[model samples]
Target chain A: MTETWIILGATSSIARAFIRQEAANGSGFLLCGRDMDDIAATAADARLRGAPMAEAMAFDARQPDTFAPILDRAASLSGAVSVAVFVGSMPEQAAIDADPAMIAGVVTDSFTGPAQFLTAIAPMMETRGAGRVVGVGSVAGDRGRLGNYVYGASKAGFATYLSGLRNRLGRSGVHVMTVKPGPVDTAMTWGGPKQPLSTTPEVVARDIARGLAKRRNVIYTAGIWRLVMAVVRAIPEPIFKKMTF
Target chain B: MRWKEMELAGWGRALKSTAAVARPERRSALAGAAAPAIGNRRSYGDAALNGGGKVIDMTRLDRVLELEAATGLLRVEAGARIGELAQLLAPRGWLPAVMPGTGFATVGGCIAMDVHGKNHHGAGSFGMHLAEIELIVGGEARPIGPDDPLWRATIGGLGQTGIITAATLRLIPAKGRTMRVREQRVEGWDEHIALLDSSDASYTVGWIDATATGARLGRGILEEGEISDASLPPAGRSRKVPLDAPGFALSSPVVRVFNAAYYARVPAQGRTVTRAQADFFFPLDRIHDWNRLYGKRGFHQFQCVVPPAQKDALRDMLRAIAQSGLASPLAVLKRMGPGRAGMLSFPMEGYTLAVDFPNRAAARSLIAALEDLAIAAEGRIYFAKDSLAGAAQVRAMYPELADWQAAVSAADPDRALETDIVRRLRLRDPA
Candidate 1:
């Protein structure tokens, strides 16, 4: 049976790496992203790498119109349809602080935008009832940090939404996995201070594959982040507020 | 485009640079991004380094864009790896015409170096098989072919003419994914050369024991290979060198013992085996970061080719390397054809010798001595493997350097593409 992955934010480093791995396994792809050129390039790469079928389409988290075409395309394709959401934005804390109104965009890019799309596709996935949904959240969602609490809060909200979605979909045979990755060496972390225990997108992609196979919910990549985040979440609010990462 | 500050080095690790690097996954980001585009950083010396400057890492842009199986023509982005291409196409009975010792080498690097493969005597260098080249010139992408005036300079041009973005290569068809190899022990220098000259196999190369002296000098194994539909087991997982090995790990005594065991493994009567294509072509690739075995200080590879008439000079060079007791176990000898696409291409209708030496004052002097021998024998040292060659010595070796410089100067008038190797060799300056 053919398995088509409807990948959102397809141009993200982690998404690209994940697509390559899945392509080699003969899975097809619907690469949806804002930059059609970049998505098309990745689609071509995916097809050449062994994907049975790969196509590119426009998608923007902030735009609802863009979401319908992708979901419609997924509906048109036969066989099992999976979705992987690798969408999110992280503007610098200083930049967000300068214009407090930027929080709306952050929430849209990270939380509400993807959640709305998932809600639209949830029924279709439940009807078929045999596929996986991988939502890439950040470890920052485990608890708000002093550095960039707004971005963290957006991811926290997204994580909660995925949790509720998983609860609703588990009975229908559709698996929803929430991936909490630590700092990945992507464009977002390129010029920043060396992040502790930072891993590559390829590593995170492999971890997601492993987690999906085990039907994991809310897994931390690099595995060590699970314990690290546990320690962070346990700290009292009084002590945590005084601390800075 | 976000430019990140990074400290990078070539494979040799002897020369390093801190540069602002932009890694663009999209082709659109390549325009007006940076100069002296680099891929994989597989070059052993300064060819890939741009100290205190800016560079665009092209590895992320790699993709197999198109393929015409009937014509055996494959179009790929410049950053695509040769080994990956081989792995992808070999099952379909096709492969890149030329692959270097390491599979990690990128197509752009292969064109810039005009790299030769084990089948050099038959297929020639990588550029000879190229049908089309797409270069980023003057902030715009331009497609050119072999008939273009810039062809000679761009191939083996050390990436001086322009930033290579993509190419259409005429890939060769393969009979199968397995390589049927024949191995034999060559007892001495003369016999080794004679055996290589007599061999008519599709692929032929000799592994030299650089530590061998006197009668055993130049003694090693000669491997001849041909593609066949023979079944072979899957390859094992690759192992990586976790850290820099201690100095004693590759000392003279240790190398001698390792070389001896490696030679003995082939046996006196020799053996025939069916091996994976990658295992036959890129034996060292199974050991990731093998350079770390040379220790923290790193090492240098001296590769030079001399005319058939200067065989005695090569023998003397080998004798010197053997006597120095500084040579690493990684040594290779092969006979090359006179097929070269670019003016500065390293191939000649003669014998080529390559040996690795741990970086030390003694090894440095030995390499310098070998460079002089190469120049004296009317031979040229490979720029891809050279880090110590003086400008005057290198200039004397490549007679067509003037022609290449003229073409490069016209293509990149601002000299914005000049790399450390270009500056170090003074390649574009007036003689």
Candidate 2:
């Protein structure tokens, strides 16, 4: 059977690489992004890479209703969604300091909205007795960083929600995965200061594909991030608070 | 040997006779004529069953084929049990890197399943250590190495490619008889993940009860340990279980109570150290029809590995099980090692959880649901313990399925060796 993957936030460079990889691996995909034109470009790229099928769908992560129709359309085209990759969310620091309206939109887009979208499609995946849901979280969610507490907190909530979703859907045959990518050099973090463990979108995308194929529950885009997080989590809170990133 | 006729899964009860087969010692006796072979029947699927075909039970072929301690390479007959090999090698300061839950499984069976153990997150599958497999392909015994395409096919081929007569396994130097075991109980799912995420041990495993709900859902015992070379001590020999117990033994009430107590006995706190054998590899020889406790219907085990990217998915899985009300008594979670090259191999660097459900009629749906979830996650089921996963799902889960099938087909075009599972999965075209 031809496996089908639905990529949320398809415009992201990492998501683009994931689409290319899946396409190269002979799988079909539905690319969903904020702009229809961007998704169309991605679909064209995926199709050129040898994807059995590739299509673009306009999506706004802030709007949960947009997902229902997209999911329906994917199902109508294919039998079911084999994998769903969510990579749409606002930057961490901006969401934290933004106005109440901006914060609400960030929280919804990052956590609540994705949760609703997942909740909507999770049943269909479960009822079909097979599917995978991949949520793109950040290493910032590992702990509250002073620089981006708001984005980190939202991602933390999303990561925690994915954990609960995984537990709920485990026995039903639906897999939910949370990806915690360390500092990735993407549009979201373009101007951000380069860190010791900053990774590229291609690297994160490869790790995501590998993690998805393995059905891993939580994956660090770069394996080193696991160790980095371990050390970060181990530092005494008093000591951690004094250190500047 | 009919699985349906024997008791299994640690309950010491007997199952009704759905099928039976007997192979006398004479039939299994090694002949000078190229050593005729048959697939190990331990496979849960039809890949091991040869419809009325003459099956030379390799279990009796139990003999040390080769052992090179200096090179850390040991070749043993297909019939040699893993427990037997462990006992033989443990004293020689060597041990198999990857061992499945049950030592009763034969070396060939391990290779067929590409079995993984608690240390899989670091050590990969049993097939990774397989230097080469000696197989009887089309009436000829040929040694296939890792580089050979047939090697990958047979490793996790479910015995579809050929009859594995012997295997040259890679062995690791043992540190000692003692193992420093540390046990801890995490409060919530997030903490549990954090704990697993943090630990780097030779062996690590978590036992959780899916029936536990709310804050207690993912709560369970986490045991992490490493071989204690400094505290080396002479190991004591173990006694074998000779026969099956009578029916009516190990009732559901008794098991439920025992399970409850076992879960309760675990202290809700940090770590404790214990003996290596007891900690890393206990219950070694409790293999007397352990599955009988589920009664006559038998049971199905759902084992899947969720990649780290999909780690949160496990929470959803746990919740679904709790809601389903299946009441799985034995649920084990562990971190798997890196991926292997076996076409149908189950290795994925991630966390794997295995749960057992009694073979009630409801179990069929539950198993199917679990399979679907695994596939959706892009996770594949362990073929060794699975009896119900459909062929299409299996193909979908394992991306290397087509490659493995092609290799097996190329190696044995005539399809000389066939089993019930191979037929069920249509591993080979119908003759």
Candidate 3:
């Protein structure tokens, strides 16, 4: 069946990589993001690469008013519809510490805003009985480290929410994949030390597509991240608090 | 490879450098980065490296902005791979007019190096097909076309002019998705150069065996290719070296044996076959990270072009390569037309020879000797494949270096976009 993919936060490096792969396969893309210019560029690229349908729409996760129009546009298409969320933002830990109000925007950008949109479309996916939903969490979500605990907590919350959503939607033949990526060379991870074992956005996109194809419930990019997080999660609070990475 | 101090190298990986790199995916971010922009780094040398400075990795910004079927024109982001463009346009009966040997090269890299391909004898260098270049020079993005003096400087400017954000390319009609390649085994250096000079095929290259001695000094495969409508089998799955190989992996004895085996694999009886375009264009790409096959230290590619009259000098260099006993399996000889688009461009009406050797002291000295031979012949070594030539030697080779430097300095007064090769060779200064 022809698949239509709704790419949220389409301007992110990971989202851009994922859409290119999908476009090559002739899948449609509804590129959602606040940067209309960026989204329009990606849409044009997708169409050039042979995507059956490529369009850009304004989407601010904090605003629900922008949700229904995108959903309505996606609903007009006659095909299995899937959604992949790559929407998330992280402020400096110190910035968030200094201004606790920053936590609301982070949670909204990373979790609650995307969750609300997914919640609105869950019924459509369940009714179709074959659509997939991919939620991108992070290795940070596995165990909150001292470096960026607030951002970690938001992703952690999102992972739990995706878990419950997966359980609820699985009965109707809907599949949900939670992707836990390590240090991906994306704009989000910009301005840091070049990661030792970091994977590219293209690699992350490939892993997510592979996970969807295999119908995996949870997957970690670079697979090594799975082991890395395992060790992190195993550390006691006393020892972890003393460590900074 | 983004926003971090990472050790990197050109495809050769012979000279390593640490640079803080920014990999921006969006077009808007391309101009804002305070660094020189680099593509796939296909140059086999330090041309793409920045050493202690910062660089902007432009691979992810690859997106096709515009395509004109009527005019056979394509505008793509600087990061777009040429292979992807070929795949996209070939199906539509149009392809990039000038594609380098490796399709993994990006538009930005192609323009920076002003690369030449197998069909260079006919199509000229990559810069010849340029329609316009969008360069972020001195913090402002501007379009430079053929009429502009800066155009020639930017084409082969080695990213010294500024960051190439997007470029409009002029494409040609492609007959099909396959290349009809005919392979003939040449017996010696004389026969090898003769075949390269006389071949009428659109694409011709000689795979020289650098380990051969005396009579068999340059004996290897001579490949002549023509674009064909016939298609071939799809490429097979790629094999990857999962880990770093031991130092002895590409030892002298092993390369000798491997080169012999590779040359013999193609029968002396000669054979003609159709191949997937990529198979013919990027012969070694199927082996992912094949550089690891040489182990972690990496390898160096020595490429130089000598005038047609300097065949004796070329032979001397080949003899030097043969004596070193350190040559890798990759070596090629081609006859280039004088159809170059930029001032510092390497192509001239001459015979160009390229050979690879693992990064070792002996190999370095041998390459240095070959570089001196190229200079003595008044022939220039390619900046794209050079990691060893000194500034004075490079200056002597390209008489137009002063013009290029003046244009570059004007375009980037602060020199924010100068890469390691530019700095090492001191291309920005004529004196």
Candidate 4:
């Protein structure tokens, strides 16, 4: 079967790099995001960058009904979706102190909504007995940092949920991967504060492509994040809470 | 419900996270199809697991078939333990020249990894000793000689080429039961290089303390030994590890103190007449669950060979590790011989370093830096001990990868003989 990547939030810079990498590696993809025009432009750019095939479609992660039809259309056009990258999410600190409406949108769009999409798509993949689902999480999930605890909590919940999904699906040949990127220069974080050793979107994209090829269960983008968060998580909670990170 | 877990060497110990399978007295009724034919599971990667495939449990196939005392050659079953080989051959004044640190590894696993020992600087890998291999291919039994393409693939082939049933290994005649040994301390990275150049022995190795930073970057103990016919009084009884110690027993503090003591114990002048068996083979096997001392995260054994021209790169790697603040107490440096005919063989006529580090998150970054340093220096990482190297890096490192892949494709067009390592390296894919 031809490998097809269905990348959520394809307009995002990291997703763009991933599309380019997949294309370079000879895989086809359907790019999804909120802005059809923006995604279309991005898809064209990806095709020019050497993606074998690229298409753009509008997607609203908060709306559960939007996924099945998109996936069905993609399955009809392509052989089957060999991989799905859930890169759609609200920004960290974007929902903090916001109204209930915004919080619900952020939570559902970031965690709950993607979980439901995976649940629906998983059965289709399970029947075929092979597939890879990747969730673009954040290093913020390694621990609840004060600056982005709300977003981190969502990612933490999703990461834990994916772990269970992976264990359950292991025997069935469906692989689930959680990617925790430390800091990526993306459309969402364009004007955000900088981090030491922050990586470019291309690096994250290349990592995801490599991770998929290796069937890695969890990938710390840029590799150094593995060590960085190791020390971060090892800090005693008593002392951790007292200091501002 | 869990049994204590001890590796073949008896050095590392682990509390059994799961129950140990009861060894059937003879081959079980379920042997052929029910269980996967697991040879010695010393394959550092997932070469042993066949997913839902039945495991053959070949560890019990321990038997030495033939020994030629005059020529120092031996034919053994795939499941025979290396320790048994040393025991059987040592008494007869012969030894398997290319032996891994642990004597518990099986002949099949050794060939699968194409292991190299201290004397690799002269003897090359265990594959060089291979005269022939008997294997089961497509349910048909066949014997392959060195000329066969499958033979090259089987050696350092990581068991994916085929199931090795038996092997004909060439053994070397040993001088005696003891060796003339020398231990010295090198102050810096340059001194370490000088010591390797100065040493004149059958085997030479440096135990580096990579934690020493700045001008003392590679300060550690250096040892060289050569087997001799001169017999001296025996040096006590061989240590036996009957049981595993507690899991968390090898704490950081304990390791540091041990490292300090080991460095302090290095004799400025040479010491002679150490038992060859105790000195060269299975020294760490005396303690069990030694790996568990690193705790639950497990550990990675990072080993790479640097070309002599890129000697400075090796020094830079040690310096980077020291500056990274991640200490590896068990770092060993040795001189390797010329590359063998095995297409994927790991050694070259240069220096090789094997270090074990507790798998901290920083392990990825630290190993990446080291790998990058090695790549820049025109060196290659050992595939047998690698867990983090990507397929791209591997392709960049091994130029003969295309030939190996072509051979594998020719042997098994369906790519049926696949392992996690193969998948990780994308070895089945066309170059």
Candidate topping lDDT: 1
Better of 1 and 2 by DockQ: 1
lDDT of 1: 0.91
Clashes of 2: 65
User: Higher TM-score: candidate 1 or 3?
Assistant: 1
Docking class of 1: medium
The lowest-lDDT stretch of 10 consecutive residues in candidate 4 chain B is: B10-19
Off by over 4 Å in 1: none
lDDT string, candidate 2, A115-154, tens digits: 8777777777888777688889888888887887777788
Give lDDT tens digits, candidate 4, residues B377-409: 888898767777878788878777777777776
Docking quality (DockQ) for each candidate: 0.61, 0.00, 0.55, 0.01
Candidate 2 vs 3: which has more DockQ = 3
Which consecutive 10 residues in model 1 chain B have the weakest lDDT in total?
A: B25-34
Candidate that scores best on DockQ: 1
lDDT-sorted candidate list, best first = 1, 3, 4, 2
Query: What is candidate 3's lDDT per residue for B296-392, written digit by digit as tens?
Result: 7888999999899997898899898889788888889998988899988989888899998888999899888888889999899998899888998
For each prediction in turn, the share of the native Cα contacts (below 8 Å between chains A and B) that it retains comes to 0.48, 0.00, 0.76, 0.00
Candidate 1 per-residue C-alpha lDDT over B251-338 given as tens digits, one digit per residue, 9 for 90 to 100: 9999999999999999799999999989998999999999899888888999999999998898999999999999999999998998
Candidate 2 docking band: incorrect
* Best of the two (1, 4) by DockQ: 1
- Note the chain A TM-score of all models in turn: 0.99, 0.92, 0.98, 0.91
